[model samples]
Target: MTVVMVEEIDPSSADAGVPAHFGDPVKEQRLLETAVGLVDRSNRDVLAVPGDERASWLHTLTTQHLSGISADQGSELLVLSPHGHVEQHAFVTDDGTTAWLDTEPGAGAGLLKYLEMMRFFTRVEPRDATSEIAVLSLVGPAAAELLPELAEPRIGAVPGPKFAAGSVPPEATAIYSVRPFEGGLARRVPLGVDLLVPRAAKTSVIEKLGVPRAGLSAYEAIRVAARVPRLGHETDHKTLPAEADFMAAAVHLDKGCYRGQETVARVHHLGRPPRRLVLLHLDGIATDHPPAQGTPVELDGRAVGFVGTGVRHHELGMIALAVLKRNVADDARLTVGESTAAIDV
Candidate 1:
């Protein structure tokens, strides 16, 4: 589906070779919200931590607790700089033996280095699995109901009100049909299922799934609407995950002793984050495109922050996720480049 979608894209509709949408972003988003929509996220990367103690070892290194994570259960984790700035984001799952870490494209190597560097006497062996794995997504009201067709190999889950993606593979879909794919619970995007399919079978699997295809544009629009921050987009090297509202999905304040935990604790217990994530309603009537990401966001003629992902949605028109000084008021009117925007309520 990805190969087919990208081949015939309008020159203005793509970025990094992925189409923003297949000409009708509005329809695509509506499908994602109402029917089933498939998205190509093979651009992501994965690492396999196969060892007898992979879970417990990762427990000490990352923000998510993994000491006794059950098979197919999953959670999101953050690898922060010692200063508590966000460095890496991993969607983690354990299939009883090996723990799989899925992350954004080009991030597996750094995460693998971190994992390997911390392995002193622990029996963990980490390897980049990008050559063998790819990620795709199914989202919408019908997403779970269609799991029966793609249930051969699956991955784990994510946390929720308590800071972990809530559904495990078996429970995410009551199908146990022996499909061997890795997955993580999408914490920010509701009712979404990510499939870590074997690279060798990707084309075939996509061809077999009978759903309308959504481009990266539709996906980004919905993500922005949900206010989920994508790593490397909403975060800079100095970003605190807390500033992007990652605490509800990635951070576990009670799990002490992890790297960067002290800083997280201090900030969580004593001080407010210096920055915060906000949803922006872009001026769609005046401009077809929202300001480019990383565009300076201004308020009262002063640069306050930067924009993240911006997209045109079927229901919401133009919207973007942005990071701003914590002092910015919720009702503040801001500007991204020359485009006017307001903090979404």
Candidate 2:
């Protein structure tokens, strides 16, 4: 497994398939904002839920409303503990017979097992498809525009999240799916497209696209700017989806019953969440390494929250994403390690 760390990444470039950047991150960020940038998400794990009742059964298990989802439509799904604490989160889409769930690295096993345990009498059999599939992403405001340019699937018309099925030309049809979503990077970038291809064609497909590569640093900067909360990075063992503001993208309020729906709904509609995920622009970040994940965040010398993903942005300077006490003033000057922090409201 490849471990993504601030210290391990080089701002300049790295070996292919590594999370680090290639050449210049500032330019990569620019590409991500204006044109399009290539990102290797093969490290992400893909799980398949195949069966006659996959959609309805899996719908009842995840936070997203999947019972009525049509083929090629994409939605972010969250698996929460009984108390509404987030346990696993994945980017999900279907191809009529099966639902493909792509989640953070090394998290597919637990998610699959949980599905198995819940299948008391259901007709769903979850399979780990990571070995057979690979994920690549094309991001930027012009990402959707490049689909036809690259001779890829024209996944258009249907707004929100969509998955259009396509293939790698010249034969071989092992599930080439394209999912274009907005929340992956941010609103600044119009859309982000994820390509799921046969593992054997991953290399050939990327070369055919012929775009500049963006590393995890650039990806992190834009993600933080967009306030996209990752599971392990943003949430601990007890993180409620509302605390990270995930309900907007990951939860369906009137979709009927699901695990953890009570707490997710109560906090989002009836009551205020005790914590909030906020953007932090820091004064002092290491020249080579951003603050480590789980670094303490304080306000008035009192511990408030912990740091999540941190990076030096192309335009935002030293920035990070943190979840803080809801009561903390938006204008309050907070501290993280030796750096002074201000909330981006």
Candidate 3:
């Protein structure tokens, strides 16, 4: 059995008590408005795919058009099971012999397992590179401005992976631009600057710029608002590409035979996936107790589906993501535990 390890970085240590939860509503609002914030996403996993055939081998298994993606261009890809269930998702960047696959936290092991299983027929070698890298996301309107200062200002987007080699200040940090998941630019600046610098400098950067540090709480809120799907929450091994809204972005309908292309193409052309991902707003007794994963959602006393992710929004109240039966009406009523939520269509 192959072993894979994940490295998680604490936001507090990275940003001096920035509160990984971002508890204050006032501060949250300020952070959202400024369009400039530092988010410590050290929990996400980074896998390095190396070997002469890395790109070609990965292109054959994933759902993106990787053959067309160059080192200067990066794109997001989905890894699906033979039955069309989403097993993992990744943002890939290839520099010919080496490819970087950045995936959600706790996903690297499974991805590595899958890759290892597939490697017997290919020439690619997959290795866990999470520990060697630290990921810091700078988002909002100011993202573009801040990113270029640390790395070469590449005028491209990071849909898959874009690479630029640059240096950071006097710390000797290795900086590279990655495609942004949000509507801004992002660069992955590898902090080789003595582990202590990342922990100490994070705070100084935020304070000096007067920008709020975003946490998981705010990250979820913003992601849901943007209708961006979460890997383990809004998607899983049970979800098909179409059902998860991955068309054109993460899935390539025209790609050659992949693990689950048959089901993906059939379901997509049929115009009826088994389930639909929708947003919802819970009615009455709004609190932080959002519905758990797989909690039954109901409409007109009939079971439709289950809640995926729920957030207690200060303004929107209780908002959630749900995978409901395709036939459910737009105004469907969903029940989670004892609370009733209304689908926002």
Candidate 4:
């Protein structure tokens, strides 16, 4: 089990009010627009599943079609409860003997626990390998340029399940490619060997490559814009996969049976989803004040649903993603907590 906590980088120290997790928001904003930026996501968890039956075991469990996943390809999988709520979202990459599951920052424990419990009947071995592997996200338009300079197997836009492997400067192995997101581009590099580069070298890498450092706040904004439903934000044990937009990205309709497959198939075939995920544009000055999750979303004196994630956009005003009743009108004027917002559909 490898676990490492990264030192926080103070955003205020930078002129752009960037948070510590993301070095400089100003630079990050620039990188988002023009160049690429590196975000150290080492805090996320990486689970390693190794064994002869790893592929079949995972195939029988998760949502994606794991049988077709080759050694060089990767797929996003959603682990859901029998009730159809998301338990964990993972990026699974196979290297024949081992399958690496990269999960969000706080989801490692739960995923590992579930994997362990399920392993009783299978030959798969699940190990927490987050610390042993570091995740560096290179985002924005110029990310493709930086990948070729790093290692062999040039980065290319391969459809589902394909990734490129390469070597980084100072002897580091990197997996660089654009992962599937709602609407934007994201380049991920998982460091294979620990180089233990000095802080100066890391800074130089960022500067020379023109990769901006991002924080959680910037990530939040980017996620909202991309309409990517995160585990904590748009998903829960009470929420179904159909309501969280996972059906469009992670869920497979014709794949072999897996846990929660019945509910997903039934919902999609019937088109009877209880709720729909919709984006909202708040109708007031942007502020840090956001409606609490599960706060009622009222439309025309009727209860619709509730807010999921809310953010104050620099230009787009206050925008949010909400789970509302399927019957709610797209143009409905809704009240999120005490704030008023229009449904962006």
Most lDDT-accurate candidate: 1
Looking at model 3, which ten-residue stretch has the lowest summed lDDT? 189-198
State in Å the error of residue 175, model 1.
Answer: 18
lDDT of 1: 0.73
Candidate 1 lDDT by residue in tens digits, 131-226: 887777887767767654433333232233234332322132111222344333222124477776777877787788767788877787778888
Clashes of each: 14, 0, 6, 10
What is the per-residue lDDT of model 4 for residues 36-105, given as tens digits with 9 covering 90 to 100?
5555544567888988888778877887656545555455778888866778888766655778787777
In candidate 1, position 286 carries an lDDT of 65
Clash pairs detected, candidate 3: 74-160, 74-161, 75-159, 75-160, 75-161, 158-179
| TM-score (C-alpha, index-matched) for candidate 3 | 0.75
Which order, best to worst by lDDT? 1, 2, 3, 4
lDDT of 3 by residue, 132-184 (tens): 64455555555556545334422222222221223111110112444432222
Regions of model 1 farther than 4 Å from truth:
1-19, 148-191
Error of 3 at 295 (Å): 2.4
Candidates sorted on TM-score, descending:
1, 2, 3, 4
For TM-score, the strongest prediction is 1
Residues 1-345, candidate 2, lDDT per residue (tens digit)? Answer: 233533365433222355666767787788887788887778788898889998889778887666766564566778999999999988776766778888887789889999889998998888999897787777876776665423233222211222222311211111133343221211111236777777777778778778778876677677888888887889999899878867656666556678998887677654568888999989875344567789989988999999988888888888889989889999999988889899999
Q: What shift in Å separates residue 48 of candidate 4 from its native position after superposition?
A: 0.9
Query: RMSD (Cα, Å) of candidate 1?
Result: 5.6
